[model samples]
Target: MTPPAIPPPGVFGHNRSLVTPHYAMMPPAGILPSRLPGFAETVVRFQAAPALGARFAQALLEIGAGGGTTAPRDDGLEHFFYVLDGAVDVTVGGQAQRLGPGGYAFVPPGIAWGLRAEAPAQVAWVKRPYEPLPGVAPPVPRFGNRADVPRDTTNRPGRYIQFLLGTGDLAFDFEMNLMGFEPGSHFPCIETHIMEHGLLMVEGQGNYLLGRDWHEVWTGDFIWMGPFVPQQFYCTGWGPAAYLLYKNVNRDVT
Candidate 1:
């Protein structure tokens, strides 16, 4: 196990809430499942308000057939949703769209959106406060099914990545991406960077280096990596492994 790195300075606030341990790993056991109004059979793994010491919230939402959110209400936050399995009907700003596997949608801050599934489905949602930039408003909601999102090979042809968001000016401050690695593929030696991360294992299993220890992460596991923390991941199972990851981007150095 490698030692943890010093977190970056100037966290979103000088508030004490951001200072927890260097890393967090939430297995299925840590999920205190809940059923809130408008949400049926959903388990929010990390709230980011406390547990993981992050500026965003993420959850593994399991929706039963004919169950979904009730109404659209803006919560002053930006959101990203990706479907891992089954099907869903996501309505963003009054437009209803049907999504199967690899479906994704992004709702900018203050935008109304809702979700429901026809069959049992596993959907991952990541949310964070809309970080406003002077003179620029957040982009309108972007929705699409990523089944065709081309996978660009990483250093190795077998390690591939697909970004659900557009490029250049259209790119939002945060990103949700899907990464796939063939069996035996490995991550970079170690990464210590400014962008923080929230990752959900979507397929297969791998050993991931988070904070000061390496954890064998399988499908359904969740990880939170604070800024400047060392991170790495590798696929060891006979089949390819994949995960949906979130990271804050295009922000100030602080």
Candidate 2:
């Protein structure tokens, strides 16, 4: 009788599962800790890389402790924020807004925005330029929380996550989603495609395969993957691992 292959240690084992390539996974890069005034005891990062064919840009994100605030600084990219926990006061384009868990806000490029905290708050924000189409005007800045909006699943089932395609009403090269993975469940497939990704694990723990490495990620962990990086996930922590997943999807050039 033939001997069994020495599979890897993860629950999924070593053999890579292949699918129709709905999306590609990238090897996530870890960001270091930094401090800013009003943002003391906070973690900040600008996650961007050349391996993913990403143009010159930055992703300004932050996770904060109790009573932390982020002062306004200009990097000149359109800003978007999603609040993971707690509350904060955000002034965008001279307008004031209060953001709570699941909250979101957009700050126009070149516009001045300031952040202040009333309690403990955790926020994830991204900055991109307002690209113009031939005839479409740049969109007005939008602000709200995830709870205020309805969670939409994909057209097909079994992926087990809420889907929000930013391209639904705009022109872009990516689709952003809040992926909710149930504990003890499985992704079951090694996704390979052309898209790059940024996944911030908001809750729970899971074994994730990124490129040639299998990583265990928990809450407050950020995962950045390059294009065509083979990957999958299996949740194992106390609760489901909910992450904010950003994927670079091809969009029409007008």
Candidate 3:
């Protein structure tokens, strides 16, 4: 849908310097507190589940007060979750861990695991079975919070952005990073690469050109694009629009 143009942050004119057009590429969509017994808000996009592209599958696990999910067995898919708010207890790969806001965990395929909310927690998760190659077994589950890691920015000239690596112990074909876009900033060109995307807005509003359509999105919205869709965005807010973005990295070409 073509979103309405929200006036730039605050008043116009001389005070304009204080006001800025806010914009951001968000993390996931429909990530809200849940009414279910064991889940809260959640937004899980296709980019995070590359193996389950547009499938009639349940990619997100939302929990509310006293909410949670039973220990599910391998459905031939990998499992990953990042906490956004509150906390939740996760049991994966025979290990139990309590994840608070900013915490994260990943369960490899074939390993049994379950999840439950502590109070009210928001988590973004993905389900895609590990692609097992000959002589290789699935890796162990991983757990941690944002504070447990460091922010790594891609030192591209003229771009100011910060991100964090998962455990940095294993190599992932894709990277999910918290992206930032300041007022009046932009991703210069329509990125048309082999990588697909699931951009979720965590904060701010902006204009995004996806394929041939210009879409305006705000916090809580999501955009999924197929490979080579030629998409770009412009930030029009005072504060930078920050969102957890997912995209394949170090991918192979045909």
Candidate 4:
């Protein structure tokens, strides 16, 4: 077998990590892995957090086979998990389910949950303090695969969206969605919205306009957009570009 190619030695190297008051872009090449408490044989890279001006935290987790939490985690926060590859067994409130690629789970606050990898696995994890609304009960745990969600293509040609969680329910304070754009497609207009967003590029490449600057992003990159920061995307690869998006909704602005 031939040896793997290596880059020529250089005095300096470049990376794609950017941060501003309005948004942040964290490329996979700039990831810094660390171990988290309660987990074994797992590495975590946090993409967004309150320290970075984000209201929530999102992390990428890489788990070795048979590795997992020592006990159920119940931290009084809502949690969302999306499997990117391999298989994982997830337990929520004593109920267990096996999640493969494209699988996702939503655990509401107060529920105990844990996960163990059936194989080497990569997962996206999001956690935030639960915001309760008067007269509206908290949402229950939800689990499903992206394949089961119907794609809504009526918005625009070459663009589609899949809502991982129900949108019509008032009990839900936030939503996670899978948005896809065929090559050469773009958002209808630059969006300047009240909702802050945590986004993970899951497929292909795109040029993202965030708060007046355009950045080239690829699969495995993560972004966090603050509220009212301008944002848009234009697909620019041979295949479709897609992202997993998180946005807080269904609550009044204080």
TM-score of each: 0.85, 0.70, 0.70, 0.94
Tens-digit lDDT track of model 3 for 1-254: 99978666433341211101121222342233334332334322332333434221223455667777764444766666777778889888779899887787777667777788757666776554344444544466778776666555455322344334453333454456766677787776777876656666667877778666667667766666656777877887667676666665553455
What's the CA error at residue 226 for candidate 3, in Å? 1.0
TM-score of predicted model 1?
0.85
List residue ranges in candidate 2 displaced over 4 A: 1-31, 36-71, 154-159, 163-167, 250-254
What local distance difference test score does each model get?
0.77, 0.62, 0.59, 0.90
Clashing pairs in 2: 26-225, 26-226, 27-225, 27-226, 28-224, 38-69
Q: What are the root-mean-square deviations of the candidates from the true structure over C-alphas?
A: 9.3, 8.4, 8.4, 3.2
Query: Which residue runs of candidate 3 sit more than 4 Å off their true CA positions?
Result: 1-60, 134-137, 154-171, 249-254
Over the stretch 1-254, how does candidate 4's per-residue lDDT look in tens digits?
99977765331395567899779988876778999888988999999999999999999999998887847455799999999999999888778899999999999998999999968999999999989988878998889999999999996899999999968677888899999999999988899998889999999999999887889999999999999999999999799999999998888877
For model 3, what is the C-alpha lDDT against the true structure?
0.59
Q: Which stretches of candidate 4 lie over 4 Å from their true place?
A: 1-14, 70-73
Residue 234 shift from truth in candidate 1, angstroms: 1.5
Tell me the TM-score of model 4: 0.94
- The regions of model 1 sitting more than 4 angstroms off are 1-20, 40-51, 167-171
For candidate 2, write residues 11-43 as lDDT tens digits: 254322222232223222334446655555566
